[model samples]
Target chain A: MLATAAAAIALIFLQQAPAEDIDWDAEFGVEERERDPATGEFPVDPYEKSNANAGAEPFANGRLAAAFGGREGIRRIAERTVELSEADPRIAEIFVAHDTVRLKRTLSEQFCYLLGAGCDYTGRDMRATHDGLGIRTADLNALVENLQQAMREAGVPFAAQNRLLSKLAPMSGDVVER
Target chain B: MRTPCVATGLMLAILSAQPAHADDLEWFEGGKLVLTNGVTTIEGTSGGGIATWATIAGLEMDNGVGVSGHATIIELPDYGWQSHGVAVGIANRVELSYARQNFDTRDVGTALGLGEGYVLNQDIFAAKLRLLGDVVYGDPLLPQVSLGVEYKRSLDGDVAAAVGAARAEGLDYTLSATKLFLSRSVLVNATARLTEANQNGLLGFGSAAGAGHSLQFEGSLGYQLSRRAVIGAEVRTKPDNLGLGEDDWFDLFAAYAVTDNITVTAAYVDLGSIATFEDQRGAFLSAQVAF
Candidate 1:
């Protein structure tokens, strides 16, 4: 009887185990593509899905784009983000010497591109852009705070904000150096 | 007069240096990090009241340091127990803790002819090293694992011996694993301990009926209600070597983080029997401050 009870308990534990091998990016709504069976690598750029609808009509089918009020709403979020970053003491130093207008425009373009707005991102890749600045995890966290505040101030729904954040979170690998 | 003046100068220098050292440390914001990282346990470990988890205390972002202090009170029907402790986490990788416990025998003492309010005091010093995996982010198949050892010393050796205890103190070694399932908003922990502590060392180590070390198990499950609160239940099995009809312990608790530096926990505990007193049910409350 004791052995049977132990086996039942072990079976229950096994049943509750998570399917850990699933790709998180795909699970979070990233577009799926074919992968090489040998190398388990995709041939196309992984980030292309985020930019698939770029240069297309805003909110045509994307839930995140519609929730953020489309292209114009994304632009507003970018502007507010830049403003907040400049005012945030923890990260203000990083923006002190940046060109405010250029930065805002790049940010607007990036948001629009990510949201499938009819715009193309012309900025450099995340790693190259952040290289040599010695950015740490704390600095990244501070920037995320500013971004969240900016999104909230711009009336972006919380769900939409989280969706966008999920897409951007993977960039930390390329951005943070310290 | 000259010696007094020099002593005052030295004291002033030490006082001034303390704040300078504190200022050099970084403080992370509250709520920005994941839940379940900073709460303090009754044993001064970074876990729930009755269970010692594999995580460390404080909100150290990456390579930062954090320190915390906790005080817990458990009011049983026939006894009262209080514990005061402090723990330090170094870069979220290692933890060092110290706790002092006082168990009030109250009416039970009178029944045993040891006075009406006899108190049993013990000191515990512990260190835990995180071995592998991250409870929150690492591979879901593998939970965070840690190894720890707690050295306990009873202050009342004579009284402990009177109760047929073999030794006044002993060491408890533990292997703990903790996992957080973010999708389900639940956390689970399991720990295996090798010890011979009777009534958590308040009654000393081992007894006439049962001597030497025995293996025990502890399990805990918690559900996150919000960014700052978690409701959990814990079960800790004890060795029955004392011939005192010792029973396993259970508790249901809620731990809330009011801020990055302050947390409060309350629980309903059923300690079963202590010193042969039956049905020891009571309330448990703990407050912790960390940074």
Candidate 2:
């Protein structure tokens, strides 16, 4: 009986010893404590870099509503050119008188540029074109109205349109007559 | 074990067949609530040839079942105001409606000896079917076309018929096409109707068959100012059924979506009424709620 009791006690002790006598330091790993440069404080935060922050939180591209003047906006502008020319007799006459291919191509380029659409514009200057055609302000205004109406019909909301038209308005002085 | 496997497979096949049968009915697998606001002229024949800009609320669901309610009100100077008795959409394809209109003839009261108190009211029952148009998804340019008919009866049948009647009651039928240009944020509508009804809802004039097969043409342009707001203008040619006038009028309308379930539409209407009658230039407002 005495031997059996000793044997049981030894078994319990062995099981308990394995768990309780763990090397905690080895498990956690050794980390060096560094002093702050200014205060010379020990145990400085490992993540601390500097206080300055600029710009915005970084985000992956194409994850948000795309920036304005993208390919879609530019394509709309190009399509508008065709629609505008077709709807107004005056604009049609201009196309008939001028080089149709060049005019169509150049107008497309100009629309992309005005929309800030991600496309290159290779066309004649606006002032030169207007001077060549003697495009009056009234005619230009009519074209603008036609464009606005078509865009409205296409369901391009007014706010986005207004933003794009504002950039194109400055060129009106050069294209239109006083 | 073999028998159990076959039974399970049979049950699955039966369940799948049910949905396949339903798919043939509608383009969208899940039914959706589609909102359509078209002018209320009550199918092509009626005594009162005039119509108001009315809105229709529609509920369409998976089994191709649809329901809708239409309402409109127009206030006239010589004639009193009128309102739709309302209608129900039976399926995603058919709609039935009733409307009542009262023309006060307030200014012409002394002339008719009705003490400027003459009011003409008629009840109209109408039904419409979705013919070829589709309320498309993922598509920005599909028209919603519907063909409809309306039967109208003047409460004072005797008085209405005496004014040179063709059909003691009236019948009107029309075809409407509506499209929303998503990229441009505008809605365009075109409608043509054949009818003989005089003032559309007024009972005084009879059908126009005696006069001619009067053709009515209408066009509308609407702009979506915001996600829930639309402003638009409409031009409609109406028949002069009352002998009181010749050419009808045009109107400009504005509508706001108060919530997903309700919409409020207001318009400035100008209907050239009877000879020297008050220019039907007045305001119209209607609120619609849908489930």
Candidate 3:
């Protein structure tokens, strides 16, 4: 009886022993994400991507794009805007823990698409992306100021800068929660 | 989830450990774009030198308080005018202002039998409330609008009576709308005023002839030259109750923000006539500081 009980206990311990140290994440069915090698952005859940996600129609004329220095200039401006916002104390709290790697890429795409620089936007819509972010009007304004500063540094003409602002200004409705 | 809970506890501990005065002086928050506060006018309101705009006088955004002060001088041919004023804006919603205007009758005073250096002074107190829309946001077609009331008291009542002004003190009402066309970099403003004051109350209110009040129109159009500069024109029509040839006023102005807290405006103004002084055109200069 003692030998049979020992064998039974030994079999149960062997079956229960973890093969590796412990993947509590795997045990709880947690999703793991790795950054893309090229883009350096973590993977997000699948969603439909369309040009409508760009939020506004592209400029019919390429004059503004030319003034903005085309796709390269626009991408730089967008990334710089995100960088400045991350550094700005007034709005740092909103960006600190956020996925800025994805932000840089998506923002560049959106700006390039909207400025008529010949790029298709593949990001989610503004409302969907900003949902639950708890952003306020003041925070949005801070972001705009940072964007303006970036454009200024890029030598975008003030009026041309406003041309892009006109398109984004209306989107405050979706982005600002309070 | 455990990590988040631990992070929350750490945040709570740090927040409680912060000094008591860490966030006390937060009322003077400034979040509006540059020059969006508008330049303070001679009347202690945000406007284009002579006309009132719907924008409140402040460097503040919502839930913040701001204050502005201005001193202005309009060097007319026969008379000199100077005004010093201060205004307070509450959360971009309401504004309260006080201005003291001094009309130095230079030679005009002597012509009217008063001393050459005599000054006609008036105190103006005003309050305004924003009614709808925003100056810089929301629908592009919708403009910011406001309603305001002003009470003016003339210090030289006897002299005002001599100039045919019936009352020494009176009330004025104003409704204004202003908009900034961001894409085009243009600004437009219009104001309708109901008043019985003569010369904006420097000559007092109404007249024995009894046209107590009349609707007046004030308009301004501006082009943004840069983030820190704007060029504008204004037309403000006034009542001729005193009949001293108090014709309409017109000006072309350039406003420049020297810094975030300081703005200076220079203009060439045309006051058709004042106290029978015809061809009263001259330079208008003003400096304002806001925070």
Candidate 4:
């Protein structure tokens, strides 16, 4: 009698097992899961999708490219940075040897690359270059202002500029020492 | 005439040596750098069959560099007495410390008779490097974390190891996270110490025969009472090695800035001792002057 009862219990347990667990793909349609969200409307994970820079140049698309005006826009901003930097020796000293103008030029180019604009930055490592300089908060704020001005002069739209700025905001802490 | 000339020359030298102060300037502007001329004392109990007492005195600079000498006196009724000491700093994100401890078994009396006599004196040298975290920076939301390691070497060999010491020389590591909540006017500092040393290597080392590691937690909360005054309370723990007592300590501390160049601190401490001996608690005060 006990053995018969045990057999009945096993049968009930087997029946209770979820069929969906046995056939997951059948329950959730595989093809329907992969479609991108509709255009003119943001995705649920907009930041994740926008920041989905999988390789060497991470900021190449979406907002950053528009901010730098694609290739021509980035080049124009770089040129202006060099002109302004040359006018101010203190600014010039912020960059390394032979990099006085190149560094400024690369800022816009780098923004373009990050915005998915298909450009390469190829700049020096951030931390090693800035260590021990005691860069003050005011110094960084000034640099950001100058870059913003150059962007405005180049006619990069305001919204695009903001999007790119947001990406760089978190790095302020690791860069500022004093 | 010669004596008068010499006196005048001496006066000129003294005047030149004094630090210049801009009399025309207001008391504080352009962010005054207040020098600390004050004493800070740790409040912890002391004394027992296994007793421990530690104190540090010196100046903590505005740039976060502190120089102070520390001394500790411990007593083991059956084993006799032991004392350790050192001087150290917290600057350039680096800490360097040196200490020496003596162990003497008084009961052996005249037999070991080398003078109060056949005691073991161990010299310890320690250095720590801060890998991350700044005590001065950060918003109220983010806690600052600083990772550091301390390497302590004991000079007296067999004598130090005889008491089941941690090692003739061993490295102690610690990580501290501190946050200053400006809006609340409170500072919270927490520390996790990893070590095998008994009483922080004060009594030579830990009793563990093999590699041993113990985790200790310390927390301090300070309130800024005014621009130049702060008061705080701290609780810290230690390991019980002599098998004689519980491990706990606490203190209430206060600091006052006397001038731009001086600060003072004081504290009441309670440090529990081994077994059931009297609590080793006392009052301490210190003064600091920075240039």
Candidate 5:
């Protein structure tokens, strides 16, 4: 009888444990996966769905590349964006020391790579690239406006433009220093 | 009274001084999410239909001011309520609001010896100041906090006296906290209020049964479906000092932003009992325009 009462008391305490103890990911249809016990990090898998580009539509890259009118078309968008940035007073200050032609090429490569056009991005990461520039919200908005205008002039569809912008939006955390 | 009007005049003066482009300063920027900032509460504070939250009224960028106006109508089986108000947010830090509410007694007035179609009018003047944290970008462990006060005055002192009310006016002081989990697209708000208002000051301040204030709570949870739409639920606990057996209030609502300047909200509300009327289920509709 004593042992049975002790087991019953233990059962009640287990039931009263905090709800956060439950593994929510496992309950929410995530596949069974292994994680390092020490770091609680999943093993790196290049082709995993939970990769760096998880939330983006799988076919967005090809669709965006096609929408931007192939390789030459992508290059036109980059050139126009760079030209506008250099002319726009709000953003021109940031590009005063940039090598225009190389910057344009790097932007084109980055855009193509993001759209899954099979091009390698040789530019620095967004955080490192924008570091110490003292970019403000207004400056970011100006840059986005210029990019949108360039895309419009390049004849990219609005939907495709937004698809790319959505992916780029998260980078604001890293790109804006203040 | 003079202060609110003066503030409004000052805001108008500043608005007229700015260029047309400056009006567009309320656009979402720097990781601010659209519609995540709740619309004007019934009392004209920034929040959902019934509860007040800690957020400012507009989509204004940090250090910018935003102003908003709202009109709300609620249709219950036994009563009708309408409210109109204006609110100003300064630097996303402080909020000043004023709302005038009219509660149509309908048949309830006639049954109580008053003429049919009688209306009870009330004025609510409110002010809220953000004290700590940001709802979206501040520390994840801590929510945005604000302290506010609503001074409500009932226009019908005779009616309130007839109903055994102790006073025709009262003050509600509240402390609210709001948090938004951006990645999950969820927002939660909780508010604690100390008040003596009976039926939110529409019936009156305190009742003959009790003149002391009671602590109450209001909470809300919302899920963002898109950049422009949010669906949410709110529950508000009320003080029962009136002896009229008032129950809690509950609502489920959806708000959609037509643009940065305009928003519309519709909800199903259960206000329980009021002044002997039971089961006050109804519909609520509100439209707001903000700069």
Candidate 6:
């Protein structure tokens, strides 16, 4: 036992001697990320952007956009939806680890583009954005309710709200991972 | 014999190799939107007050189990009706339900040589399977559709037979389609049923001669007045097998979601005639809770 203690002390010293030469973070595959100063969002790997990334076709006319209170209203609804989902008990856990700031901006852009409120969507594709989140059908529905609440609060007509829903409803195949 | 033995060994090995995976399964997660599960019908299934829709019975979503219950009352000029039931929804896909219904014959029973205030009772058990589409998702034009089966047993066997009914038990098969066009704030449901029931099996099944299956139709249209309120109307056509002048049924109804889990419905119903009594029109009221 005494010899074993001496050997253990020697092993510790030997391990510490090489610490300065070890690229610990790289060895562990940890990639350091910096938040963009202007956007307060960490950079993601580059991906091609297209309107198709929004996962739905935009409205042909401004009628639907007008009903949603134009670009400002769409932005408000998207931000409010993100806020509500983050606070909701049924789905708060899924949003906790994600950068909500980026989510708000992308969601706002997606909504504005889909509603034809005169904005280009620069967010990641729906499937790529939600990949690996293990989101289930129930989680998708929970987010849908949060969006509905936001739209209702914005005083959008029920029919007009449904019009937007019709566009996004089919994207469940991409958003739901479970 | 060698092949059979090898297959059996393989099956046993596969079964024994399986791991306990209960932790991966989710249960009882209630996240369906308000009133999306629909109200319980008279037969205990999810639907409008008088007709069953393609929607399931509980507030559970695609990965949860949900349960719901309801109590209903209806007043006619010559009779009283009451029913209570419970239902279970599985993964928002399948539903099982049971209901107990009572038909009160205030003075009509005495007139028919039975005691005053005699009541007829029946028990109904039903199961529904959603086949395709969704009420609130996917293609807006493709409505939710389902198939269902209902089994009814009457408590008054002797009375039912005496009243020219072929039997005291029967079955009903139904196919339904429903859609909620949220943009229009309108919801529509249509159902086709094959049945042998008389007065919904409260009186009994079939003709006295034992010949009785018929096709029927139920249609409902609803308009959303608010997030939690809807006004609708329904019409159901029944076979006049008993020749008791049982005319088609119609009702105008309004439903309100009092909370995320409770709903109340009231309607004015017209039954046309029953047991030789004409103009059996009155009021209907129902309350339900789900989670």
Candidate number with greatest TM-score: 6
Best by lDDT: 6
Q: State every prediction's TM-score relative to the real structure.
A: 0.68, 0.53, 0.88, 0.44, 0.64, 0.88
lDDT of 6 by residue, A34-143 (tens): 88999999888889988889998898877799999998999999999999999999889989889898999999999999888888899989889998998887788888
Q: Arrange candidates by TM-score, descending.
A: 6, 3, 1, 5, 2, 4
Better lDDT candidate (2, 3): 3
Cα lDDT, model 4, residue B246: 48
Candidate 5 on A101-166: residue-level lDDT in tens? 667876787777777776766556676567798776546666766787888888886567756665
Model 4 chain A is weakest, by summed lDDT over 10 consecutive residues, at: A42-51
> Can you write out model 1's per-residue Cα lDDT over B79-142, one digit (the tens) per residue?
9999999887776678899999999999888998889999989999999998987675434557
Candidate 6 per-residue C-alpha lDDT over B1-291 given as tens digits, one digit per residue, 9 for 90 to 100: 678679978998877766544323345557787788999888999999889999998888777789999999999999999999999999889999999999999999999887899999999999999999988776778999999999999999888888789999999999999998865779999999999888899889998976688999999999887768999999999987778888889999999999988999999999889888889999999999998
Clashes of 4: 41
Tell me what fraction of the real C-alpha contacts between chains A and B each candidate also makes.
0.06, 0.02, 0.64, 0.00, 0.00, 0.51
Better of 1 and 5 by TM-score: 1
Q: Which pairs in model 6 have colliding backbones?
A: A159-B183
lDDT of candidate 4 over A47-82, digit per residue (tens): 222222322336533555655767787777766766
Please tell me how candidate 3 rates in CAPRI terms: acceptable
lDDT of 5 at B117: 84
Candidate 3 lDDT over B11-37, as tens digits, reads 998888788655343476777777888
Pairs that collide, model 3: none
Writing each residue's lDDT as its tens digit, candidate 5 over B1-291 gives: 678779988999888878855534443332224564578887888899999999877655453667789999999999999999998777677889999999998998899777898999999999999998767553454788999999999998888888878899999999999986654567899999999888988878887766768899999998866557789999999987668898999999999989867899999999999888999999999999887
Please write out the lDDT profile of model 2 over residues B119-232, one tens digit for every residue: 666777777776754432212344667776777777766556655445546666777776655445566777787766666635433443466346787777877676457778
* Of 1 and 5, the candidate ranking higher by DockQ: 1
Question: Considering summed lDDT, which 10 consecutive residues are worst modelled in model 2 chain B?
Answer: B44-53
Task: Kindly give the stretch of ten consecutive residues in candidate 4 chain B with the minimal lDDT sum.
Answer: B44-53
lDDT by residue for model 1 (A12-50), tens: 888866687988887798876665676453443344333
Ranking by lDDT: 6, 3, 5, 1, 2, 4
